[model samples]
Target: MPSQSKLLSITTWLLGLLTLVAMATQLTIHLRLNFSLVNFFSYFTNLANLLAALVLIATASLRLASRELSPALESARAVSAVNMAVVGIVFSVLLRNVDLGSLQPWVNVLLHYVMPVAVMLEWLLRPPRTRFTARHVGLCLVIPLVYLAYVLVRGAAISWYPYPFLNPAHAGGYGGVALYVAGIALVFWLVACLLLIVPKRRQVRNH
Candidate 1:
């Protein structure tokens, strides 16, 4: 029988491969539709999934090689897990009913549902040994903030937004967009706090 760590390594590798395949499938669909590669990659869902895939693959590689995992790598995995969770939540709550023309149902499920849940489960099952500080939480927020700014700026220039909620025209102007952004930011912060706090609480209880 495989040891628990070996099983986990296999699982991570499979999940990472699955994510990459889903992404490639989506990219193929987009290409057939003459979609801009830039626009396709710009979606938070795509970016988050990419990050999750990379982290999963890297962690699995390190584990399989019997290498010591770096704290920074573990931190990256935590951040990726948080981002993916938010991606799933925001999509289900805000864009569930939105018509996503040309997006395959299977691809949608993998990106917005399976990957997110799997990433979070992985984090819960194998948490970082290094405790997350408030500094880590703050650092986790940086990527989303930067992504938000990039989306808004790029949207203004090209008039294309990944999600309807972020589009000023669809969101009832910039005010509405601001409200949506603020709400998502709050959600991200709350989730980050919970992820960090829960681990510490668990460690305390175990001691």
Candidate 2:
């Protein structure tokens, strides 16, 4: 019989593989229909999918059981988990009006909703052994900051931002961009705090 950890590992691996396939198929269809690879890759949704899948695969491959992940891996998993949730929330709130007829609707749902929920559930179920400190909050911020810089710089050059709010050409302009960044940064921090709380709560329960 498979151990509980082994079962957990297998479950994550299957979910990750499912997410990757759905994402890949959707992206392939999107590229074929739109013929704009650059535009496709620029979306934060795609990046989130990629990040979640990679993190899940890494966890499964390492056979990470319990809440005992190394600090670095724990941080990575936390960031990735939050990124997935952000993708779903942002899509529903900000991008729901955007038509997604090019890709299968089910795949779209999987990428935006199912996978994000799955990642979050995984995070909650497998709280890390190492509780993140306030300082690691800054480290968690780095990935999103880098993502924002990439979008802004690329959009500046090509006049094509992945999201309307992030585009200077849109109504918000630089101010809008700043506002979006600030809002997202706040969200990121809140999510990080939630992630941190899990481990600390578990520690408390143990004592």
Best by TM-score: 1
Using lDDT, give the best candidate's number: 1
lDDT of 2 by residue, 1-207 (tens): 258768878888888898889877877887777668877777788888888888898888776544445677878888888788788778888888876658688888888888989899888988888767888777778888898999899888888887888987773679888998899889888887777788899999999
TM-score each candidate.
Answer: 0.95, 0.88
RMSD of each: 1.5, 2.4
Per-residue lDDT over 110-146 for candidate 1, one digit per residue giving the tens place of the 0 to 100 score: 8999999999988888777778899989978999999
Candidate 2 residue 188 C-alpha distance from true site, Å: 0.9
Q: Which pairs clash in model 1?
A: none
| C-alpha lDDT score of every prediction, in listed order | 0.91, 0.82
CA shift of 74, model 1, Å: 1.0
Show where candidate 1 strays beyond 4 Å: none
